[model samples]
Target: MLDLGITGVQWYARIPGTIGGAVFNNIHGGTHFISEVVKKVKVLDKDNKIRTLSGKALGLSYDKSRFHDFAEIILSVEFELFRGDAKRAKQVAFEWAKRKSLQPPRSAGCTFKNISNEDKERLDFPTTSAGYIIEHILKMSGYKIGGAKVSTSHHNFVVNDGDATAKDYTTLVKLIQKETKKKLDIDLVPEIIFLGEFWFGNVPGCQGGGVSSTPFEERVVWD
Candidate 1:
């Protein structure tokens, strides 16, 4: 985007994954969300037919989208952007990259979604951040299971300190959920999508069901 003299997506510089994945997850950075720039998307619907969906049809929201519930293949996407100085955009991206330098070197990014505003208010918490709850409330930073460890630098990230298997990662995630529920009575929702069948320890919305053989079956379609 910077090379193309486009702005508004500089926040994505610190985010992992493709643009389509960002849209699918409705990924956000700071106060800006990918959904803010989305204009429309072309998709292959469940009927095996092509369709264009825009606005509410996409069901874009915080760290969520219709892609979470529907089986569709994203073919292409149009984004609204502003013409900006490439030099300025690059500078902003560089700044964001440096600020996010604490991200775990080997991790899948944030493990849990931020608490919803409703939960935050109900819990009487000052912030809706799941990382804050993990690190401050539960005091689970640096907690480890097998080779998977909750990153001390950023509590939301679970890092693989080498030799960490898929089971190790899933086990650590379950532990986080367990501790959160036990301490705060809040169910921490996972942010990363599960690929294969794995243990989820009775986490709501994540019980049973692994990645399906069909690509369009409750899949994240990258445009």
Candidate 2:
């Protein structure tokens, strides 16, 4: 894992996923997604031939990569970083942690990406943040669908609240997307990964529901 030592920036603030998942999801926080920082990617094709792609060779946008859509597995990734002070970096990280603590514990983090700045400005949107947009629509601390609830602290996050089922979460996400589009004419995409059978069964437009036939499951469990 390559650390860019990004400090005092909201890019690393409150995002709950990892570098690998961020790469896979095309997660863009403040300025740009991980794709923007990628210098090169080493890939193994179907025949197991090792190849390297750099610059525009690897097509990327929104939370997607051309290689990510395929069967290729990322052995490791390299990122561009700069020298910085450890103390200042720690201070930034601490502030971020404090801010994130205000969010619900059961959340998977932001549920959507903001529309482009041009569109937002045209709509007279107050904030480009997805959480801000949801808050405006709901006009409450939280919005509930069955056991799932849009977090009181942050709207973009749908919290499990102990009683939420996979179905509840999925339904709530759909509702958020529908509302956002209806009101703002912008589509909000999910940031959290729907794992296991849920991915195939729940995700729209995916072929053959109820998980991939592959045996592998990619998850991050920090001790």
Candidate 3:
């Protein structure tokens, strides 16, 4: 969009979701969010009736929207954006694109939100760095369980090394959570949204890796 002189969507160029999904999750980067540009949204209610909602009716907020867990299907969205200098916008997009290109092509986004300054002080962590905790404290860079591994390129993500099952991902999540708690006494929460059943730990007659029929290695989509 920025290449065409659109500016509002520059912050979300890296997001892998559709327009509706972005609004549903209030997708954001730095100080900007999808809520800021959304003019309105159209959704299908449980009765399969179409409803037009004002931006405020969507109740968008920190990683949340009314459509979340409401079982409504987002049909479309309208955005209000302004014209900007294409040259300047392209420069910004290029910078963001450059930074995004550094992370794994396929991996969950940051495993956890950074601890707040107050939380950092309360936890006695020298700094509010979740990546620091994973790498410096847990020493888990490039660590793996099944097909899931901590990205050597970035400590905040778990890369699916092709053919990974949901179990592989969850197991890795558990490992990070477990290790962080054990080593730093701080609990790490995930930002990924699991769409289906996830298995953890050993269970009789159960294998946690939720393998798909065909494996794919593609641009990593972060949630």
| Top-scoring candidate (lDDT) | 1
lDDT of 1 at 149: 91
Write the residue-wise lDDT of candidate 1 on 1-223 in tens digits.
6888889888778776786788888988778888988999999989999999985689897777888678888889989889988898798789778877868889998888888889899989999999999899988899888899989989899999888998888888877888889988888888887774354333445445553433322342211
What are the root-mean-square deviations of the candidates from the true structure over C-alphas?
A: 5.5, 6.7, 7.1
* CA displacement after TM-score superposition, residue 69 of candidate 1 (Å): 2.1
- Deviating ranges (above 4 Å) for candidate 3: 1-4, 121-129, 199-223
Query: What overall lDDT goes with each candidate model?
Result: 0.80, 0.65, 0.73
Name model 2 segments beyond 4 Å from true: 1-18, 84-90, 195-223
Question: How far in Å is the alpha carbon of 139 misplaced in model 3?
Answer: 1.4
Ranking by TM-score: 1, 3, 2
- The superposed Cα distance between candidate 2 and the true structure at residue 141, in angstroms, equals 3.8
Task: Please report, as a residue range, the 10-residue window in candidate 3 with the lowest summed lDDT.
Answer: 211-220
Q: Which prediction has more favorable TM-score, 1 or 3?
A: 1
Q: What TM-score, computed on C-alpha atoms, does each candidate reach?
A: 0.81, 0.73, 0.79
Clash totals, every prediction = 0, 2, 4
Q: Candidate 3 on 72-186: residue-level lDDT in tens?
A: 8889998899897778767766777777778787786776767667868876778787787788888999998888988887888888898878778877887788888887677
